[model samples]
Target: MKAILFEAPGSDPIFTDVELAKPQSSEVEVTITAAGVCHSDLHVVSGDWDIATPVVLGHEGSGIVSALGPGVTDLSIGDHVVLSWVPSCGTCRYCLAGRPAQCSLVASVVAPLGVLHDGTSRLSKDGRTLHHYLGVSSFAERVVVPVSGAIRVRMDAPLDVLALVGCAVATGVGAVTKTANVQPGSTVAVIGCGGVGLSCVQGARLAGVSRIIAVDIMPEKLELALRLGATDAIDSSSTDAVAALTEMVPEGLDYVFDAIGKISTTEQAIAALGLGGSAVIVGLPPTGQHARFDPLALAEADQRILGSNYGSVVPQRDIPWLVDLYLSGDLDLDSLVSARRPLSEAPAALVDLAAGHALRHLLVPSI
Candidate 1:
């Protein structure tokens, strides 16, 4: 099968033929229909985040179950599924508390090694082992993932668009509905207007927030935000985002989400909050990146800064709900998929994503 491999940071992604190992215990083999080109993968390619070398580079995708390993009973062949980067052990403390996103096994072992739960990869090229990305490695035509990582969704939902629900949609929308739990009639601002940021806009709308302020440097994204649900838009390229937000809401916003995950956006989200509002950090910054804020201000204002990882979502529970939302015409997922290209064109898709030329690009294995 064909797959894209990232050998190291600052190097071009290689689209090469690779051999896939069969599914092992509690694992399933999925024939990937569509893979989302996301910033998280770009971070690894750009050296913003470090990971194991010689790995497949996609984490968000949708596919059909082609084979199931021994001991797997919840899924079957031909089932449609959405892949999750964070696959949890249901017996873990975090999973028992309804916080599967913080699964201890994935954090301690799977992530650091870029392997599956068994601590081994299923991809190789010319007998040279290749690591998996976030345990999904959906960049390939097929992937072997643990059952916990593949959430079965409705067959009616288009597998291509459903791919976004795995990452950008799940993270952005989940941050609003799950992490911050923003109440209706609240004022909100989402900084950055990429795939995740735009999804944040939609999430706020779905939550029935009164004032939705969409912030971004790109004019196209700001326009898209308005169409999705943003009541107002701010272009940070020519105008100061924080100042514009302040002018729009003099008393500060009820909630502010920094979906860009930059130091500047984090500080801005904190500064733009109301007396008791929360600043939800939804985007993932490079490892070791830090943001500085005033402790006195937070204490005086009774504000909060929350770190939302993967929107604090339980994949099995949330991914299907998102699919239902899309199928029912309430969520606008089609708008998020700006383009679709063949898996071999993943390198160019990464370039367009990094340049902010697209919202969400899908890499279809068949295309």
Candidate 2:
């Protein structure tokens, strides 16, 4: 199978023919149908993460089960599924406690691709091995993944759109629905309007927020936000975002989401919150970078700061629900896909994504 391999930072991933392993007991082999090129993957290829070199980077994806391991019974060949980067071992303390997203077993497997509880990789290439990023390496045509990492869903669900469930959409919607627990009639502001940010805007809309303010430096993004569900748009580049949003609401917003993982945006989100309002940080900034905050301001405002990962999404619970959302016309997945191309063109898609023109791009990994 042909897969995208990141050789090093700033280098275009080389598409190479690689041998794929069969499913081991408790694992499943999937034929990746569509994969989304995400900022997270960019962060990986750009060396923004501590991931091992020559790793297969994509996480957000949808696929069909090609084979299932000996012990796997929950899913089988022909079952369509969405891939999750964070694969949880149900026996872990977190999983047992009903917080599968926070499963410790997943934390242990995240960094290295040629890893699992077994300490070996199912992925490898030309004598060398490949590591999995977030358990499911959707960038490849087929992936040998743990059963815990793949969520079985309706085969009829539009495979291309469902690909977003693996990452960007899940993170954005999950942050609003699970992390912030958005309240109806609440006033919400979202900074950044990429895939995740746009989903946050839609989440706010779905929650029935009274006011939805979208903020970003790009006019095009803000425009897209409005079409998605934003009640108002702010060009932070030309305007003082804090001042403008504050002027519009006076008391600030009930919820503020910083979808861009930068200290400045995080600070702005914190400053734009109303009393008792919560600020959700949804972006993946460089690891270890800290944001300075005024202790008195946080204290006096009774505001809260929350971190969201994968939208606090429990794949089994959320992916199906999102499919239903798409079914009911409650969610817009088709619009999120700005372009589609063959896997060989994925590197160029990455370039376009880096140039900042799309919300999400899908790679036909197997076509």
The most accurate candidate by lDDT is 1
Residue 169 of model 2: what lDDT? 83
lDDT of 1 by residue, 42-144 (tens): 8998899879988988999999999999999999999999999998877889989989999998998778798899888898889898999988999999999
Estimate TM-scores for all models: 0.99, 0.97
Distance from true location, Cα of 41 in model 1, Å: 0.6
Candidate 2: residue 48 Cα off by (Å): 1.1
Q: What value of lDDT does candidate 2 attain over all alpha carbons? A: 0.86
- Over the stretch 1-367, how does candidate 2's per-residue lDDT look in tens digits? 8888887776778888877788888999989889999998887876777777677768889889999889898997999999888788888888888778888877876545447546677777888887777777788889888898889988778887899978888899999999999989999999999999999998898999999999998899998899999999999989999999999999889999999998899999998888888989999898788997777888888989999978888888998898889888999888788988889887888888888887799999655
Q: For this target, which candidate reaches the highest TM-score against the unseen true structure?
A: 1
Q: lDDT per prediction?
A: 0.93, 0.86
Model 1 TM-score? 0.99
Give the lDDT of residue 3 in candidate 1. 94
List the candidate 2 regions with Cα displacement exceeding 4 Å: 112-114
- Residue pairs in collision within model 2: 85-134, 113-131, 113-132, 114-131
